[model samples]
Target: MTELLGIPPQLLFGQLLLGLINGSFYAVLSLGLAVIFGMLNVINFAHGALYMTGAFVAWLLLSYLGIPYWAALVLAPLVVGLLGILLERTMLSRLYKLDHLYGLLLTFGLALIIEGLFRNAYGVSGQPYPIPSWLQGGFNLGFMFLPVYRGWVVLASIVICFGTWFLIERTRLGSYLRAAVENPQLVRAFGINVPLMMTLTYGGAVALAGFAGVLAAPIYQVNPLMGQQMIIVVFAIVVIGGLGSIMGSIVTGLGVGVIEGLAKTFYPEGSATVVFVLMAIVLLLRPHGLFGRTRT
Candidate 1:
């Protein structure tokens, strides 16, 4: 077996693949966070809880309603998105006029409530979600074996990320969204329903979180605390990429994932702390984040 830097090529490639898979999740989750913060200006602390809800919804559909994984992919997000709309209309909208910290605190409280309810309903143990028959195998690719489901995740994440970027950066609707974010009063004067747009944007952002959760259900055990474990790392990704910067979130997420993977291979002791260390370094050197623009 060929060796690179004294590490077996297979082992190296395997870790890279794992890192890419993790990056996919990070990109999707962070993209959602960026969208919400960019337009709504509200830091959604409950995002991880919503993500956990998405996976649980998928699990419920499969276990109770006899829904297949394929169908749940389409349905779960919609269900969660609707829930998000309700939360926004009833709860989040009330916080817009207050300080950003108020919004954060409210969402954090909501997260605690949601997580607590789910924890009470379902024990802490992770429940297995069987992979669909069509995606139950792997292919050998010269250097490493690639699982079909994992490959699907990477492809789907890339497609979704680019598609979102295009919608926000290219389309007329996107232009309106950006305009409203800049000056809601002006956009409203032009007869656009700014409030509705905010609601929809928030819902869409949460839906993205739900979609990521569905994707994760098959990979990670469906457990109440799953989102809690990932949310902090994702927040770090957002900070490193620049808060509210869509492109920054996607690129930083993938790059950091690969870096973390490499760290695991070269220095196991630092692997877990690498992302935080990177976060600290980025804060010290470029507080606005790599892609964030400094406001004069």
Candidate 2:
């Protein structure tokens, strides 16, 4: 009954929570996009398709193989990651020296093919994915009744996001990864298999997308078209945060989600367009993005 800013606490927190959940998906998805672009200089337009494949893989695992959510969480990403590696080796490798647009177009075409195949096999209708039994309940946090699964999404997202940042920024392997991106010949001279590293990097980046898809399976219906809906917004988030900036993607994702949630609370009509509007403003003032580094 009590109101904050003339809105019920339930309504406010509910939308805020919803926003954060969506943001979790954005963080993970955008992180994958950033990693791929940062290290490989490839704009993976099929990322959405890859994400969709992840959810489908999880659903198939459960429906046919009797695999549970916990296993699917790990298995789905691995399955898709291997697939990604195959794509990189067989197809993407050919375009490394070509214009970035060539790679984008190739992946975009691949996205269309993948989406069409899934759409034909599984109609447009959404299939429900039940939440795991252990994570079914809610916790009453004084003002809000936070669902266990939703809270898990937020926590897992934060840990994964920060953990990824640490991995790429702090670890020796990460240093090698960065070095290879900066100077592949130099890295190769140091006895690193640069090409192999690139293949693995792409696979790993795509695995992040697949992992996010698995995280989203229960919250959103497992559907063929689900990725298409989220990918554009996610691309926007990646650009706004800064291209190729790992920390920027994570922090901006969480922050933008909260901002969007607040806008939804205060001005519901503008929630959908708010992010783009911010994108325009940020671009006008900062061409490299809020977190992107400017090259000399």
Candidate 3:
């Protein structure tokens, strides 16, 4: 077998592909986190739970409503996102002027409650989500086989990430959002609905998490703890990429995924700790993150 750097191409490329797929998830999830924290200054510990909710919602829609994967893809996010808007309107909105710690605590408690409820009902076991009929196949790449679904994840991640970046950084609404973040009063003086925008911003951010959850349903077992496991790594990605940086989250996510994937092949034992280790190093070296802007 042909080898690159003394490793078989199959092993190397296979992990790379897997890494990229994971990166897509990271990008999608972290984008939401970045937006929420950056815009609202609230630490949403419930983000992972929202992501888990998205997966379960998709599963429910399919199982109960006979909704197909494609339809569920659109509906799950919309459903969860609506709930998130409600959450913001009723609960989260009250805490904007208070300390970030309060928001974190509230969300942390919410996460525990949400996860506990699901566990109580569904038990701890993982449920399988079948691949969509159209996405069930593989591509023969000669060096390594590529799953059609996995490839779709990569493409979807890129489009979604880029779209998010454009929405936040380039578009007119994004400008208002950024402006609102910097000076909500000023934006409000301009006749823009800052409060409503904040509410919608949070909803949109949560929707992003739901979208990622649907994408991941077929790949991993749908379980309550899935978000519990992923949330820590994602937080690390957010910190490593720098808070309030959209592109940073996207790029850093993909980079972390590839690095972790390669680490699995090269150093199986350290693969688990590599991201945290990198986090520590980045924290020591660049406190603001690689692409993060320093808070004034």
Candidate 4:
């Protein structure tokens, strides 16, 4: 076995692969946060809970409804997205005109409510989600064994991340979304439904979180607190990437994930704190974030 920097090639590659997997989740989740904050100007504190909901939804669809994994992937996001729309209609929509803190508090309370309900129903234990049969194997590279599911995750995340970037940066509806946020009165005067656009944008952003949840269901146990654990890391990613910069979110999330993985390889003690430490460093150096514009 070849050794690099006193570590076996296999071990090094394995950690890097693990880092890429973590980065995938970070990219997708933070992208959603970026979208929501950019358009709605509301920080969605309940995003993690919504992510947990997506996983649970996938679990329920499988356990009780006998729905397969492939179908659940599509259905779970839609289910959660609809719920998001409902939440916006009844609650979140009302907060747009108020202080941003109100939106944060409402989302925080919603997160607690959702997590509590799931705990009451499912307890703190995590439920198992089986890997899809098609993805049940591994590839032996020269240096390491790569699981098919992990590869799928990385590929799917890349596709989704770039696809979303293209949608927002190069598409028609996306233009309207940007325009509406910039000048709702102007967009509305042109016969575009700005309010409806906001609702859809919020739902879409929440759905992205749900989509990531579905991707994670098989990798992580389906538990109520799962989202809580991941969300903090994601928030760190968002800050590192910049609050509303879509490309920044994707790039930073992946970069941080890989950096954290490397930290685990060289210094195990700092692996957990690596992201936060980077966050602090980034804050000290560039308070608006890596891609954020400085306010005058």
Task: Score every model by TM-score.
Answer: 0.97, 0.97, 0.97, 0.98
Please give, for residues 113-153, the per-residue lDDT of candidate 3 as tens digits: 98999999898898888999899899998989999999998
- Could you give candidate 4's per-residue lDDT for residues 1-296 as a string of tens digits? 33637898888789999999999999999999999988898999999999999999999999999999999989999998999999999999999989889999999999999999999999999999999999989999887999999999999999999999999989999999988878899999999988888988888888888888999999999999999999999999999888888999999999988998788888989999999999999999999899987532
Report the Cα lDDT for residue 81, model 1: 93
Candidate 1 lDDT score relative to the true structure: 0.91
RMSD of each: 1.3, 1.3, 1.3, 1.3
Which of candidates 2 and 4 reaches a greater lDDT? Answer: 4
lDDT of 4 at 276: 96
Question: Pairs clashing in candidate 4?
Answer: none
- Considering lDDT, which of the candidate structures 2 and 3 is the better prediction for this target? 3
For 1-296, candidate 2 gives per-residue lDDT tens digits of: 33636888988898999999988888998999999989998989999999999999999999999999999999999999999999999999999989899999999999999899999999999988999999999999888899999999999888989999999999999999999988899999989999999999999999988888888999999888999998888899889988998988998888789888988999999999888998899899988888899743
| Best-to-worst lDDT order | 4, 3, 1, 2
